[model samples]
Target: MKLASRIFFAYLLVSVICFSYPVSRFVRDVRMFFLESVEDALADHATLLANTVGTQMEANRFNAEDLYLAFDKTYSRPLAAQIYHFTKTGVDLRVYIADTSGKIIFDSQSRANIGADYSKWRDVYRTLDGKYGTRSTRKNPNDSTSSVLYVAAPILVHGKTAGVLTVAKPTTSINAFMEKEKPRILKLWYVSTGLAILLSFLVSLWLTHPIKRLTRYANDVRDGKRAGLPPMGRSELRDMGLALENMREALEGKKYVEQYVHTLTHEIKSPLSAIRGAAELLDEQMPAEKRSRFLSNIRTEANRIQDLVDRMLKLSELEAQKTLQNVEEVQLNSLINSVLESKGPILSCKGLRVTCEMDRDVVVQGDPFLLHQAISNIIQNSIDFSHCGGTIGISARIDEGMLLLGVEDEGPGIPDYCRDKVFDRFFSQPRPDTGKKSTGLGLNFVREVAVLHGGGIRLENLCGKGLHAVMTLPM
Candidate 1:
């Protein structure tokens, strides 16, 4: 089966199972509940009628004529009342009376019931023995709907048991209500089930969409095409995409190393050529001032080469380590403070002011040395870019169970075109004051630290001025 269909069926099956059981049980229970309510109301009516009949039963004088007249009058009256979903046109209740000796005296529906021996009837017999009594019987053997309900109450005469009065109602009318309600309930259930299935289908599509994008991106990578990570919502699928991207990078590590070596060699050629040319010029006879200038040029070119190699080595070491070692709980506030204190002299010389908005106790679990170096590099970049008397901001807080550390500097912000490349290895923008670019490995190293600590770092231009670098680490 195809994926969409598989998910559709799986979701539908589970939803149907979950919905059908409770709905069916509820329908059945609802029918029974209505029936019980009817039975209770009939019980109360039967007792009240019996009490009225008992008052007319005097010593050796059964005023059965008046009782007969009452039932006759009651049955003759028309009932045009509408009771919710059903209508009442006439009395459906059958009232019967049996004496203490179990001899039937009156039956509302038939003449044959009068004077009939009804003592053995459960409703009559049980009520004669001072017990609450009821019974059900089918008028037809093969017709299940012919079932009738009977409720009986004792007739009391001068505080003595007199006879039994029974009231009966057929199930046919009650079944009519059940039959009518069944289809309506089923209709509602069908509508609900259809809606549920639709929602599940849409949810399935939503879930699989990201995986599809990831698959296409992987295929492009396999085809030797350059591709970046696909955008994804915040979910487990996003995490899986990240892991896949990391895996792809690891798999191409050899090619990446070769490319790095080629680029490093290409970049060092200019400085190396400058140094060698200065050395060659020094070998010839030259004025003292000219020789000294050449010597200074050689030293400056050599130092630039040394700085490039050192930065590359540090970045390479960071990239090679898959995980942080000897992790400890390092307080970010304290770490930033230490870095600032170490660079206090430089800040003062540049007439720069640095302020911190951080609690003393905000901490993270990471390699303290790496985290310290990452923050130091960020601060150094801000210090380098900032103009004289510029203000640098450092702040820390906890967000969504992660530590958020932000560093801001008031300087000429990065250009829009260079924002995306800020964290790229060996890509640097010239500083505003000196118009000189350092080896662009600082932000990249910070990014590696973030990845190792299961976190992330982002550098963006602040609104209306400067740049802001924020690092987030899991708590």
Candidate 2:
């Protein structure tokens, strides 16, 4: 995966882990706090009902009918237990009244539970003994939901305790409410978690996309392709890209100016010498024929210098051009043939035989004029180095997505010591026949052309023979 994606996902995972525990704890606390509020409501209702029953028994008006009336009234409300009314739901709420002798007087919900002297049952027993009493349950016989709460108070007559009135209500509603709430709470958690995950995924993709673009742009720069950055909002990443681009332009500009000055001087030196020699001859008062010829030679050399300067400047300009809007795919074979046709007379005059072996329809995309000059320079160099009546061979092919263009000759090869410096600006080798002559900027210009096209060039001695110049370009 990409670096940006890796970082984003890592951050998402850490954030989720860090936040999840707190959210879970808060939900649990809220549930417990709410349940406690409901529990408190249930407890309060039980206390009020027990106190009302105890008051009636103290006035001696609490007979069996009074007890039944009390139950029916209590049963009308939530968590209430009126023994006679509970038969509709087939549930039982036990009520026991005990006399001062600890004798049971009334048991409504369960007949067997009455008159057995529940003076021993905790709620009745404790009230009879002049202590507070509350909810109690026997082990459930039929269901886990059978737990009950009991509230009891002392009955009095003539300012003395007579018996106990106990009220019981089953704790069924609270348990049922809890069951219903479980799924609802889980549904809420599910929705919240899904939204969290979705938001995380989108944010992760957005944050990382620009960084991925930056990595690819860096690779293009390393591969010597046209590389540029889009404006991204992130300050640090944008600064890094701008800095790299500035450094590359600064280095290229420094090297280009230095090379331009050296090649210009080298190119003009020959013409200057020719013009100076011609002027000296004109001073000697020579024959009209030779005088006119010398002057003509000066003009020809001046034109040669001018052509070299123009071609070199064009190559340099192409090197720095950010956009290749004029570029297109052209057949390499046809282009090479055109350059060969242009050099035909020169090769013929040198008594050189040209051998060509290029695949048909070998194509490359580039600026046509620049590509033409690069190939022309290499072929011309081969021709210049070949012996009279010797052979200059040109060939091209594709290897692993790269187009390989080569020129070879069967003349004396360049010495190994000078081979490394052959393509440096203004570093020329001596002409084989004419001693020290020939401009040195040709190979340097060819190298620049290769770089502009995201390609490369190298010169090496052909095996057991003359010079071999190779240019490799991406197809």
Candidate 3:
């Protein structure tokens, strides 16, 4: 998974864990509040009815006929209450009375419960003991909808408790409301969680975006491509990028200077020794031809030293470049023709034949100057190794959206043991004809150019022949 996604999910998980208990508690508290309101209303009804019955009993007017008549009378009522997403219509209330002796005196809804000993019931038992009384009972053990709530109050005669009046209500309606609210609350939680996750995802992306840019910049530097620090927003991340850039500049500068000093010192030693020896030999009295040969050797060694220094400087400049300064569409055929033209004199001197085979439309996207230099180096190597009157083959073709340039020469190929080291700095194979080695910066410089242009170079022995060099670059 991406870092952004991991961060988002981690944050979301924590948020959900933190909010879950609180949200659940809040919903539970709300439901309890509504149920408490229903219980309070029921309690009030019981108290009021008990007092009226007590007053009638005190005046000797309380009787079973009045109780029956009061409960049996038809009363039409209309109710339109919208409780959340549900509606309410009619009302149903149950009432029962019991004597102080625990015998049932009246039952409004069911005669089966009348004439039964009600003293053991919580509502009547507690009210008789002069305490607030309430109970819940299920009419059927297996049926949840059969649950009912009862609240009772004391009936007094001459300030003495005589009986208990109980008001009861079934919990079916309340359960219906709760059932509807369950899914609604769940839906609300789901929506809240989804929105929270989405917000976290966006926040994660915003926070990590700068890090991603910095990572890309680091990769470019590692690949030796010319790239600049990406713009990180005004945050600590921006400060970090700046610090890295400064560090890279300091370290690369120091390291580059140190490497150049070491390599230049090492390569100049042999040429300097040769020149010194030739100069010392020239001091002796010798034949004119012999003295003149020593002078030529001294001059040749000095010139070789100069060439080595120049090549080193050029390669250093190429290596230091992080990216190409000039990028253009380069026609492969044209570049090849230019290089061949430049090398025509050498080819003529060696009596070698050159063959060019190329697609007229073959093109690549790169620094044309760098491409030309790289191709020229390869051709020069081939020319140095080619036998007199042998053929040098140059070709360019398109392969899988890339341009492939090949140079082949009929000369002794690289030995198996040293093929891998051919592109190493200051490592060169001797020329086939002269048995002399040139400064070994050419192939290395070419390799650096190929990398800068997102291309590559490979040299290998051709089948039944000499060396073949191929350079591949993007089209």
Residue 393 accuracy (lDDT) in model 3: 93
Q: For all the candidates, what are their Cα RMSDs to the real structure? A: 13.1, 7.7, 4.7
- Residue-wise C-alpha lDDT for candidate 1, range 393-450, written one tens digit per residue: 9988888899888999998888988888998877888888778777778888888888
Pairs with steric clashes in candidate 3: 226-322, 226-323
Per-model TM against the reference: 0.54, 0.65, 0.77
**How good is model 1 by TM-score?**
0.54
Give the number of the best model, judged by lDDT: 3
User: Candidate 1 clashing pairs?
Assistant: none
For residue 201, model 3's alpha carbon misses the true position, in angstroms, by 7.8
Q: Which candidate is the best by TM-score?
A: 3
| lDDT minimum window of 10 residues, candidate 3 | 68-77
Residue 406's lDDT within candidate 3 is: 88
Q: How do the residues 1-475 of candidate 2 rate in per-residue lDDT, one tens digit apiece? A: 8665676667667666656776678666765675455445544654565465566756655568666676666555455344332323333455667777667777665445555766567777777777877754746867666666677777655557767767666656545555566676667766766776777777777777777787787787777665556677758888887887798788878987887886687678778998998989899967999998998998889887877777666666766766565788888989999999999998889899888898887889887887898899898888877788999989898899999999899878888788788877667777786675455768877887787677889877877888888999889
Query: Which of the two, 2 or 3, has more lDDT?
Result: 3
- Residue ranges of candidate 2 with Cα displaced over 4 Å: 1-10, 33-255, 351-358, 433-437
